[model samples]
Target: MRRRRFVAAVLAGAGGTAALPNTAGSAAARPDSPARHATGHWQPRAPLPVGRGEVGTAALAGRLFVVGGTVQEGEASPLWASTAVHSYDPRRDRWSVHAPLPKPLTHVGVAASGGRLYAFGGFTDAVHLNPQPDAYAYDPRQDHWHRLPDMPTALGSIAVAAVHGRLHLIGGRDSHRIVTPHGSPVSLGFGTVSAHHVYEPGTDTYRQAPPLPGEARDHAGTAVLASRIHVVGGRVEDVGDNLTRHDVFDTRTQRWLRAAPLPAARSAGAAVVMNGCVIYAGGECRPGSSTDTFDDVTLYDPHLDRWKNLTALPGSRHGFGAAHLNGQAYFAGGSPTCGGGTSTDTFTLSLHH
Candidate 1:
């Protein structure tokens, strides 16, 4: 995440994890190390062909797919929201530009299911004002992209998780509709919606489910651990008012439970779990903090209900996406600045522990 426009996420069913090649040091190799025991190190990988932020990335069929987002061609080129889909093959150390989306969509929620890639609601472009209702599916085996039925409500920047055989979409925002007496945008902000939607792949249709509790929130991190979906660290009503509130939704009981809060409250981060620890990394922090974008990483062991700060990112960024492969975590395509400019470079965190 480039700390660029913050967003939330969800992973359902058995999400795929990429296996990383051995590049980082092992504890046995560092016998005198106290630091290695504290947190792992970050490794670099081949860069994305195009630099983008606020994009969608998901792993399907053994490859990582980077979906729509805002792309910066350069200082001279105009910033544009993108439909470009790029994929990375860790085994080949190579990248390929895949079929672009049918439309340019930024701030999209993406996931993989039924051996295909699914993209949910998104902003029409990086302008971030117009929300889209389109839902689509990409079949790599056929090199094809097709439209699925639109969401019951058009919302963008939501968290999606695949549980069992269904996709769970939670907490996103529609374009702000209310204005004030002075014609100013409402101060409370038009940031989040407390809606929960479920997509059934078998039916190619969507159904309503339970909404998130309390005030609406966006830009949270979501993951399925021990069979429950955990939503954490998002803005309550606006981008700057980030939260550390953690909510866990039980897929079986169809209810939510309060869980351990994030050590740092942030928006626009990526959440990934490996080896029993759910890691929340990157995103925007304070409004004017010198390093507004976060590079620091935190790991939460659900079994223990504790959080530990790991190694900081090689650099801070937000609006990116994360995937795990070969016992390591990979973050790709985000802006270096908390506000703008995208990076084509890819960074990896080695989970040696």
Candidate 2:
């Protein structure tokens, strides 16, 4: 699949804060006060116990578990080499070490299903374009690990969401080797895939489903509502290009449909459904120099068929993870710089009109 590269730009103002001019148009309607947009600030909380980014996170048994990400930028040493797993207690803002993954891998796509967390495909080593098909399951109840059938294809930067008790695996890169971040000439192979599949937990089997309208990977996706999965901005090429298009799939119909585009084009961001709206935060964009990353925040409303700009991250971030804890969305552990740098910082996005 063609992956879109997130634009990276240097922050010209104080403390490397990138100032983005709001795109022209009628601003997204304020459905209610205190719903975010008016308040452009994120509340800082306890940071991730481990300092890593490009990690995968999911909610299982009411707790957030983050797994396998690199410790530095442009190098896959940390993940390609470690199998450590960490669990977070959002209620108390604390972290605890848990049973490690069977293998050390990073850039994984994670989803909660059948009372377990399913982690699939990601770049495991510092090697840029390398991909893997290894899959694993984390059972919070037992605090243990188990292996599962590998995905039909080797995929990385995949987006996984549980719809109607089934796990939907979306578009991702299919290369088995690493590539340069600058889209430089390298032997690392690249291919765009449009395959979409759904896994049935009851039978431990995956079946083909309608592919996305476009072959974009490393995009953000979430179950904004029951039985519906919404996928937003992703790269169509493996070189990390950017695309703002969004799509929603109805499991009942096994079909995909076009929806609103993100206010800002992005890829490799995190997303979640909170308080009835699909909220996505912190990913990278292009037009960036060697140093900066995108700090933009965008929200999508299926009811209004539009996107609204909200608060930006305090600093540059990409590969950050996001999930709804309580009524707000909590995002953590993303690369401050493009290729491999990671941040342990965690923040809560307070939504208000």
Per-residue lDDT tens digits for candidate 1, residues 159-246, read 8887887889998878574323255332222557878999998998888877787557777887777667888887764455688877
lDDT of 2 by residue, 1-353 (tens): 12334332311111211112123323344444233344445888787766777788887776777887775433334444346677667788887889987877777888887789888887655533567888788888898889888889887778888876778888777764345545654344355466788778778788988776654455455555677778888766532466776777767766666777787667777887776677777666555453456787776655556667777887778877877777667787887866556777888787665
lDDT of 2 at 96: 80
Question: Best candidate per TM-score, number?
Answer: 1
Candidate 1 residue spans exceeding 4 A from truth = 1-38, 178-189
Candidate topping lDDT? 1
Clash count (model 1, backbone only): 22
TM-score of each model, in listed order = 0.84, 0.83
